[model samples]
Target chain A: MSQPGPDAPSQPLRITVLTDGDTRPPGLERIEAEADVVLAHDEASLRKALPGSQVLLVTDFRTAALEAAWDAADSLAWIHAASAGVDQLMFDALVESDIPVTNAQGIFDRNIAEYVLGMILAFAKDTKQNVRYQQDRRWVHRDTETIEHKQALVVGAGSIGRRIGTLCRAVGMDVVGVARREKPGDETFSAIHAQSDLDTLLPAADYVIIAAPLTDDTQGLFDAGRFKAMSPHARLINIGRGPIVVTDDLVAALDAGEIAGAALDVFETEPLPADHALWGYDNVLISAHMAGDFVGWRDALIEQFAANLARWQRGETLFNPVSKRFGYAPSSQ
Target chain B: MSQPGPDAPSQPLRITVLTDGDTRPPGLERIEAEADVVLAHDEASLRKALPGSQVLLVTDFRTAALEAAWDAADSLAWIHAASAGVDQLMFDALVESDIPVTNAQGIFDRNIAEYVLGMILAFAKDTKQNVRYQQDRRWVHRDTETIEHKQALVVGAGSIGRRIGTLCRAVGMDVVGVARREKPGDETFSAIHAQSDLDTLLPAADYVIIAAPLTDDTQGLFDAGRFKAMSPHARLINIGRGPIVVTDDLVAALDAGEIAGAALDVFETEPLPADHALWGYDNVLISAHMAGDFVGWRDALIEQFAANLARWQRGETLFNPVSKRFGYAPSSQ
Candidate 1:
């Protein structure tokens, strides 16, 4: 971190961008102007570019090829994810290495919170039935439930989960949180319980929200036993990774009327097959994994990364650095 | 207003309920035990019951028979409407009469506010389209709009409108209200503009909610000229009376793409005929006129009246008294 002498100029920062396709990120001109920009579509290209790169910008955030190309990162100092969740980037080697990781943490918090609120309101108002009735040209009047004093249990206490809790509380819902450990809740949650208390908390929650990152401990967290612990009138909302819930168990739970309804924006499989049983249920609301993808979000994502990149170049501490062992940024950070 | 001496027993309070059908309001046992309860199914029955009644409760909230039976209300001291809006009861005779009218005001405020918020969110998230996509078994990924920082214009500054503004502000929307006069806004609206300033406000509003009651001044308020003044991307949500929005003008506006969409719970015609053209639009969301009728709402309405009746018997100031000329309870009241 030594400053260069008056006669000498530092070398340009070399950055390898691991992309899903050949196309580069939009509005990445600022980054490209001052750095050596290497776009890699796959593991072979990423490996070839990694030797001279001082930083890795993961634009293809979900690719598994980063682990394969890890051995060639001879000059890599920091790794940045263009997404909030760095689940795919937390490999055994990366977690065990001295390299620090940062993610686009705060970017998706409010957007995802809004999406969750919309889902919650949609369920409470029976909006899906209203749409169906409109299509049938039939006038059906049904009394709706209110969320004013209802309880919401947010499964994750990350930035996204906290944002969800804040908005829920703003609309008069009593929100509680589940995290790695128990703590007194802040302005968002009434109380935050340890993950171990989830079974006891599940029964009281009128709405259970999954906003955790995909991790070894979180994957398959809401299985048959967890669903059984929830109230029959409770609704399950998953904006987190799909693998976090056992799909078969959820299907069984829905079929048996063990749970009232679910609004899932993610599934274990991407682009759920047309024959999927979940698609046929009237009580289940299904959407592609797009809870946080608001219009102009790409530009916002690039802007967030640009800020972080500038901070890295200046040797200032990066924001949203991940706690590698936990696989997501801890609340304290 | 003088209290009777201990030796004088007070006569029972006679109440006439103008109903559209023979069935009386549920849980009337509490009221029937203390008073002379008359269930009138038509104008004739209401006329006969009204001669000796001191209290009149309108359960068929939209009936026009109140005006026809007005002459027989010789002993009437106060009128109570089970529904929130007192538009139907604000007849020429009633407006000039010394009798006071009370409505079920606060009972529907939060419920209607939730409904309006639900409609706003449904439009912002393209929830109707999402439901359609799910029905088709298609995994469509489209960027959605966010309500945060968006502008909302709520016409009517009564309890329901204020509640709507409060909820919209809770979700980070910039809310402005349209009322009878210009005033600095409170906790709900950023500003409350007089009705004369609506044209200037319309162009900036992302969502226009008609929460005003049906009065002479408000009837046919949203006409062709007003629609033309609105942003093309704006949505109209009417949880108030239907006649406030001219049906033909609204249809034309939607057809011409002058407005993006509408969520109409109240139509000029109830149970909006199956053959109505509004039923076929992909952008129009139609529901039976039950926005504020959450489960147990009837009980809530009855409970509200029971409390007000107790106050009336004790010669205390009645709650939710209407300004007959204005049709609904003014904010000052």
Candidate 2:
């Protein structure tokens, strides 16, 4: 795994994408046909074919065989992961290498933010319960509420958070952004409050949305103290990393009526345990961290990588390059 | 229904709220505590209650009780409906009379728009399915589509539609607004198109959101012809009245794969009939018309009404008074 790609190919540099049983996107097959394209399910064959490959696109994450294949790849120059929140891709060994890594970031920001808002509205409007009742054919007429003219304290003002805040603000909700560090004169928001303002914002906000990237500062940010500060009628929606919110603390908060309701997309554990209290709770909406799922997902990621490839070929910077300041260096995690 | 109140000892105006329930906002109790407030449930009760009542706050359209209430009320000086759509409240009886009618408009406009965006996101990214799958303890991971850079077409470029357009634009979507009559030099929209231009926009849009009122022009606007013109991948979300999109046409569209998905909050039939095929489709997300549901709803509505009430007392016009184009007075419907 110590060599670079062939100095130059007769055609464009060949790119091999090992995805989860999904075909190459519409235009990608044509691109691959022009280059030395190889599709593989297992890592051994992909690695065997990797010496000629300049780009390796991964759709799935963290398989032992894939790791083994990566270990043997002699000419794998760079890896393009087709997922947001590439924490799973950043193992010790991979980060210890100088290989530049890129992810589909802005691609999923608005989509995921919309997903969070969807769950909030769905739960608040008793959409599922109403559907169940409608299935039973009940004319159970009830007055509904709305998310207008209410305060929304959005934690983690990243790309997704900015989009979420803008959308929420357009809908008449007062948007307050909270980040690790405050930016200067950022008044597009009512105020760009830092993490310290959580106490003041928590109690006042009708909705608290978590959309920050997972970091040391963000881990366990939504715990008992934060939840308690929220009004009993307030709601919490987290699309960020699961550990950013302490699940046990959230459960206690919900149990004690510290907050009105909560929705979880990402969990501290994947495929949350069968006995997890979150599944049975009436107010809580639980999703399997699949807020980023869609019909043309692979195609979208491929399109992004394809664009980045053009940028790379033209000696231009990538579209969504994660900055080194976020504790992500090429050779260090 | 008619009685002299001890508290409102001035020229007492008996106010009857012709609602299913809970038209009471925060400051509503003060009016109830002062004036003779009556809850009219059935047509007979409403008829009996309206004789001496001055104001009727109607919240439901379940029965012909409103007609009866209007018929029996000799001194019916004013009426207010708790919903934005005042069609059910304004008819031959209330329209012909000199009664002043008002509605809760501009209140839920943006919030409802946000809900439409949320529903769009939900369908585009499969949020609810993920939630259900998570509950079943599935770790199934899949690629999701992105909403960024999509083209959205908003129908009925009023307050709600405009808000929905802006919200969509904020998420990097190119949004076009459609209305009955295009307002000249409307800076709120990127491209203001006539309602007739829907056919051209329908095929280009990834999302078609209906936030228009249930007017004669808009009723059954999204019928079969319109549905057929839409791309099979595009989603249709109706925060407008259900009748706007023929429910049967929508069902046919969904079953025949004319469109990708739909999130119908309002229905042609409220508490959408038990055996409706709309509920049976996996792709269709039935929201029981609760896109406007959120916490702090009552307080928000009340505050708006309070401000309007003060304006009314000061002999000033209200903020969201319905247009008197149909030879009907502005009755609070």
Candidate 3:
């Protein structure tokens, strides 16, 4: 285990990055200036690189190769996930290990919030129908619903959820937040309820946004029963982990017209197979797990990782340290 | 001429409503209880009904029947337009007449603002692409732009433009307003500029929103030259009048990719003739002129007109009185 006190390391730290080779963080040369850097793509490369590496940077958060190579990581002291959700990287070996895990948290909050707001507005304004009418060269004048004074129940009380609530409030929405723990109401949320209240809150929501992490408690949280509880006119937007929503149950709910529509950025199986029935639903909007990704995000992630690297070099506590037990970085607030 | 003083009329006023036979204000029975109500859908009916009517309510503001039958309007004292823009009704005979024209201005302001925000968010988050990908059943991950900290220039300092600016500001955008006359800065706009500044402001805007009235000064304002002045990445949104943008020039600019895209609600022609080339553009989002028409808008319009009618009956000053010379209701502010 690495010591916690402020003592400079005697030698250069070994940093191994796991990515699909399409995008490694830009400005990585800044980190390479001090450390010995290695890029690995698959299980074989990761296994070969994991031994004797002091720090592992999971740029490709989707890969579970790290878990398979955990026994080979003899000198790994820390892991940094270049993503807000670190569920894929949270294997039993990692949770049981003494290594500290950090995630890119604050970086994606406002971007994801904007994405959620966009989806809400898209549903309210019926933009999908507008596109359809345009495609057919048919000019149909239709009345649209206003989102103002409408109820939005955000299913997470983390930074991203709070930011989503704040943006929604700016547009005159009545925002309610549901979290694992009860929290006092703030400018963003009119009220914050415990997870136990989700069943009660779901029916009242015109928009339900999921920004919660995928923990054991949250896995399959939004199943058939919860979908059945939501208003028929309500929309579901999930930017969180995909498994949190039972895909088969969601399809059934959507098929039954239990809800108006949904915008799913993440999926249970990403690169969501081409033959998936979810794609066939006109009411269901599908995007490739990129709600939080903005142009230049790679540069920003590199900057964040460099800052954390500097802290690690100084033996100081890292920012956005994730709680292995909770499966997310606990909110600093 | 109707006298302007605080004295109730001895006789009930005769009201004629011009509509397209599709929608009439809901709960209009309340108004019918006090006045002699006549509904007319065409020039023949309008001309026959106009002679003895004390008030003419233009529910279908797109009609020019009022102007054509103006000589037959012997007892028409007040004209109420159930629309913000009175351009169509601002014919020579009506504008030169002493009859006071009142419009449903406040009713559309916030709703149109919401529509503009929805468009801005749609452009930023690329919701259009999301739909296309969903249709194709392809899950391709890509980075999206953020609306926060982006610059939006709204061309019109009226209530609608101010409302749009306020909503944009609430979502962390920097808003600039342009109008015919200069005004002091407000919470919504950082600064208000003269229409002359539009040339200078166009380049700096990431989003250019047209909310100005259709007048001699504004008609064809966004020609090919003006489109060229905008950034390649900037998007144009017109919720105002379609003639304000030269349709052919807009098509040329769009084809040339001079601007990123556009969301055009009101077009130069109604129902935008099916074979028009504008409908073929993937980048353009076309919606029928229904931005301000929310679910209960007709009811709201009736309520506004009813209040104005009560004032007219009491011989009191009316709300939303248009400036004949300017072609829109003069803002009381």
Candidate 4:
């Protein structure tokens, strides 16, 4: 990494956040303090701030600014998103430019792992129904099965998946991990199943969790055929992207009793349309994609951006850089 | 604590398990191996078996059997119900009998404690809506709060309540235990609050969990006045007997936004009528009285009974005896 020569002109660092909610992240203050300008979504404001900046801190690339700047970018040199899934922002921004795009990959790993554990506990223990019954003023006592020693299959060996495997191990569950590249280092997993082993793993798992990224190889992965491979008592939980599971296939799986129940938080569309049939099912538990949402999450994202900022300034290889192999290297790392 | 005298006469033991659900706990072979006769809610069979048997195992006391046996002059003296709650059973069968009674008190403490933690996580993390949105094809996103350092008021320092407090402590929560009686030798509690101190403790708690038995003082405990005392951001969870909390007060609390929400798992009634007003409230999480329904529970109970049986066969006082202070005794100790 070469520094600016004595005669070279210094440039104002440009910062773009992938998605900006109502409150700006505190990381923005750190960026502003160290640099000259801050550019982010809230479109009009980004447009005004864009010309004077040189670095962009984005959590996603779907911003209209990124779309508009795809072919016209001149001053923007470095772009980073504050999330694991950079596919939405990185593909269009990165394939076209030599500028490096870093993502906040490791931030959500443990958090999302906790989310998966929460959903699994809810489903296996029949937790939500207990809440529903008390509302009816009924005291119906019944036996429910716990998760101890149950067979579980994790579809991804990424950071979140590995963390979930560790937590599952703590609860005395038998776990297997699946991935594109076989890794022998995962001692927490009973065995690392390859992508081709998914079919073999499906029938044996009492619970199947989707934690993999959505790639061409992974997209539309759990369709009708895969759903049929599951046992009627088996349950499916998707913490990854929505398209990774074909919605109709899941509905059919539930309908045919190929699976006992589903706890889904990610879907193809959100604020879901009023007339969705999956809403009518008894065995399904739908949550707004809030598993990884905790109050202090803003601080986590801020820390990620702060670290990436240091890396960008030093011109060093950043943590969670988009993998060169995947065209869109997004992660819930 | 003396063993049976050499001159003592031995006779067949009669076991009557008066439970709601139509099932048997595992390892019934042990009971059959020792008991000369078994009675399971069959009035004629129980009548026949009761006259000669010396011991009775009352399975949670079905009311009809209690009514029929009150007048019977049976040799049976001791009765044991496989439950922690003994209010209704005590009222019906043990008020005048010289027979001793015991209960399955400590068996469910850990499991129910785990259930309380499950509810807390569900309430704070929004597992309810997570299940709802997945079916609607929505990837809903929102910030959620955690219980890391929040204050929890556990309004029962009995076995189940203490276990809940322990689990909460493990999660880094500030725990306060409240009960009718606070013994000096009871070091399990970090801080003790009397029943009268509930109001003083309510405002500081992010969660108010009711795990108290239904006593004269505890019945209708969380009436409107108590709900009003809680913080607006607080959540109320009841895993104790239903009458302990006045249902109408809960509704009013939720309606007025006096508290964030509630998770209830028990009620005064069974099979709550479909039209109950409590069912209409969206903020309430209702579960049938099923906090003790985890898998392997039957086996665990059977093992407990077998150990207790060995003690009972000898002339030792039972481990979970009903309070003799009240002057009434169960016939199946």
lDDT for each residue of candidate 1 in B89-121, tens digit (9 for 90 to 100): 888888887888899888888988998998888
TM-score of 3: 0.97
DockQ of each: 0.80, 0.37, 0.88, 0.36
Off-target runs (Cα >4 Å) in candidate 1 are: A1-12, B1-11
- What's chain A's TM-score in each predicted model? 0.95, 0.82, 0.97, 0.88
Which candidate gets the maximum lDDT versus the true structure? 3
Q: Pick the candidate with the highest DockQ.
A: 3
Ranking by lDDT: 3, 1, 2, 4
Best prediction by TM-score: 3
Q: What's the lDDT for residue A112 in model 1?
A: 87
Q: When superposed on Cα atoms, how far off is each prediction in RMSD?
A: 2.9, 5.7, 1.6, 5.3
lDDT, candidate 4, A1-333, per-residue tens: 122212124654555453554556655676667766454565565666555445667754334456655543456666667666655653544555566666666667665766676667787668666655544455556677666688879998877787778767755678889988665645668888788778877998988999887777788999998998888899999888888999998898888889998877677765456688777777777766655667777678877777767866676666776764573454343
Candidate 4 C-alpha lDDT tens digits along B100-160: 7677777777667767777777777787665555445555577766666788889888778
Candidate rank order under DockQ: 3, 1, 2, 4
Model 1 lDDT tens row, A101-179: 8988887788788888888989988999999988889999888988899999999999899999999999999999999
Q: Each model's fnat?
A: 0.83, 0.46, 0.91, 0.60
Runs off by more than 4 Å, candidate 3: A1-8, B1-12
Better candidate by lDDT, 2 or 3: 3
Worst 10 residues of 1 chain A by lDDT: A1-10
